[model samples]
Target: MILHKDFASVVGVRRIGKTSLVRVSFNDLKDNIIPLSINLGRLNGKNYSVEDFSRLFLEGVTDLIKNYTFVVKLPE
Candidate 1:
């Protein structure tokens, strides 16, 4: 949980379920928290800059917010 201590890099050997763990955590919190998780491993050959990553992340979040009306709805 202390991700801010050492720059927060989740690194390990192959097939170690790092991505799965993230996915599970995301799923568990998706209802109360808006999150976007991207697997850079899938884009192994594709070159992407920080700007590209930010754009992708924002685009995903925007799409999620659009569909999850609770994100925009207010309770009285």
Candidate 2:
């Protein structure tokens, strides 16, 4: 289903299973969609600004997608 073209945003409280529903739905479109889940809650107490949040989220998504491409894993 087209999102903005067909429907508006679905609003709900945090941790209310919104992501679960989205994941389940997105599964059906896996052939065309590369879903990325970022837990922005990681910034809960960090007091990150809007720009900070955007940067962090992008970095997290990039890492999630590219981690598998590395020839060797780094030590934790």
- In order, the Cα lDDT scores of the candidates are 0.64, 0.69
9 in model 2: Cα distance from truth in Å? 5.8
Q: Which regions of candidate 1 fall more than 4 Å away from where they truly are?
A: 1-9, 27-31, 42-47, 70-76
Tens-digit per-residue lDDT, 1-46, candidate 1: 4333323356678799987887677688644554455555544356
Error of 1 at 69 (Å): 3.5
Tens-place lDDT per residue, model 2, 1-76, is: 6454333244477879977787788777745555556666667666779987887779878976785355767899
| Candidate 1 steric clashes | 0
Per-residue lDDT of 32 in model 1: 54
Model 2 spans with C-alpha error above 4 angstroms:
1-11, 45-47, 63-76
